[model samples]
Target: MAGYGDDAGFQQWASENGYDVPSGTVAAARQRGSSYIDAVYGERFPGEPAGGIEQDRSWPRVNATDKWGNAIAVDAVPARVIHASYHAALQELQSLGSLEPVVVAAERVKREKVGPLETEYMDGVEGQDALAASTPLLAAVEGLLEPLLTPVGGFPAMMVV
Candidate 1:
């Protein structure tokens, strides 16, 4: 005669009677139950975007390619890494008080995206996670430039951006 009340009391009694619970099983069960309820009741998870918009269009479009002219996916990490790395390097250079050279270098690099040298670099680093690799590259650039940007001429104290 286990009604909901009896079921609840029985569960509590079993728990108090030294029933072993597996690690994380309660949390996992709760999550699965919650997701099932949401699915059935048509509730959205917090901050989940509504459907029908292209989510991957955040980055600027680029025609990635190999030296042999083979097309690469725009979502490919090596290409994205090179693109983000160049931009980050230019930002570092600008923070070091030379915006003009960085601009020129950026323009040059942009034009050289299809050149042999960039192709070689990309090929060597191909199949690696570009975003992960770019993190250390950015950190190293910041480390080298931070000391040179210390306050001067009544400027505010240097802060790592």
Candidate 2:
């Protein structure tokens, strides 16, 4: 199996075999093999700005490898873990009926305009122009999040928060 720290070797092998690896492929390989690099290297390489590459000096670097023998600097797994945890928490909050009120309020506020000011300003201009631009995004977010607040085998939970 190709372990970490094999990027250069992999690149060389790929080149010798007449394969053209793209930049994205290199980035993906680096991401996947980041853990392996962390295991080998002491979690960081020194900052060398001579090449004009903007390195995050504060973040520790891992010596990741690929199927070949190329090495890369990568962030440690703790960052990924923390990010995933935050997303999961947000998902759980959505599942627990936390975001429904905000959506309902937004819809209600848009619906309750009474005069030309409300219609022209809110609906005609802001709603039709500015807010309309975001309608697709809003719909997508609602579609993705609404189910989380819906009870299984029942109607969607009413707006409470």
Model 2 TM-score (2 dp)? 0.18
Candidate 1 residue-wise lDDT at 23: 38
- Model 1's alpha-carbon lDDT is 0.30
Model 2 C-alpha RMSD to native: 18.1
Candidate closest to the true structure, highest lDDT: 2
Q: What is the lDDT, from 0 to 100, of the residue 80 in candidate 1?
A: 28
Instruction: Estimate TM-scores for all models.
Output: 0.19, 0.18
lDDT by residue for model 1 (14-128), tens = 3674444343333333233222222211111112223214532222223534334555455432322222223332333334322112223233222244545553233213443
Worst 10 residues of 2 by lDDT: 35-44
